[model samples]
Target: MHDEYNVQAGLNPRTVREYDEAITRVSLGYKSVDEYYSNSCSCHVVQHVRIPLLCIQAANDPIAPIEATPYSDIKDNPNCMLIVTPQGGHLGWVAGDDAPFGAPWTDNVVIEFLEHLQKNASKPESS
Candidate 1:
């Protein structure tokens, strides 16, 4: 399933189960798999975004590997910020002593980042 569905594994032609293409086409209404990917992929889409965008990704994510990160584009785009954590699993970033009863560590990080943005939003720039 990973080989058939993962974007990283789409570089080569691999055998999918019978009716896989037909099922995908019917469900998604895409003429071909390549057409679907071309329209839906964010690798090139993020570069065109004009609003502030915060992207948090885990380096150890198995579903979406760290290698798939668009580092150069994020670096060049002022509106984009990518935070790659050394440790985290997909949407699970359990941390702190009270993690079992509290929110994930990412919640704090996101709140802090948003607070910072809000605080600086009204500040006048000095030329």
Candidate 2:
């Protein structure tokens, strides 16, 4: 279903099945797709990210399954922030009071977060 959306949205030039076949032949070197995804997939690379990363995931996103999220790694990492909202399917957090500037809710979130950082940037460290 998510693949259908991607193809319909023109994010991918080929259908999901064709994309999978192309991935298998050109990108994934392992015999099994699971093994290739386990090692080379972007979803599995969060543990290696070294910067402050804010990840926003919808609890009911049809495109990205909740099971694929790096819950444990995000919980264990100080540099990672994971926000799983009950809504916002596939980056659709738009119409809300928080969205004051005709921007997406995620944009508002990042704007507020950056404001917080800027406001607190000059404070001294607490012992």
Candidate 3:
């Protein structure tokens, strides 16, 4: 993603000059590549997702690693659930392996959750 952004920025002459100036001013005497990479996680935003969330993570996803995802913090929420699978490969999990339209695991899980919500919603309310 970062590389793609860099390429796009380079293609724009104005952006290239702006970026070069900014980097020259900010980098100073920095030598290592680690200094330029951002290390912060968006856990603060995760803590604020008050809606009923069903996060499905592909166990082998390289971009969105299961271990780095903010599931643990929100897992205790009554309205939240995290389903981690061994396959899927990022957002590439297709359903029905050889079928025309893959049988995505997300489809079943989301449908079940919605059904559960509908069933519960139809229950009579107590006075």
Tell me each candidate's TM-score. 0.67, 0.61, 0.59
Order of quality (TM-score)? 1, 2, 3
Best of the candidates, TM-score: 1
Which digits, one per residue and each the tens of the lDDT, describe model 2 over residues 83-115? 998987887888678564577768878888778
For all predictions, the C-alpha RMSD in Å is: 6.8, 6.6, 8.5
Superposed by TM-score, candidate 2 places the C-alpha of residue 125 at a distance from the truth, in angstroms, of 2.7
Please write out the lDDT profile of model 3 over residues 6-116, one tens digit for every residue. 344344547333453345224443232233322334454666777777788888886556666777676756666778889888687676656537667678779999898
What is the Å distance of residue 28 in model 1 from its true position? 3.3
lDDT of each: 0.71, 0.67, 0.62
Output the number of the lDDT-best candidate.
Answer: 1
Check candidate 1 and list the clashing pairs: none
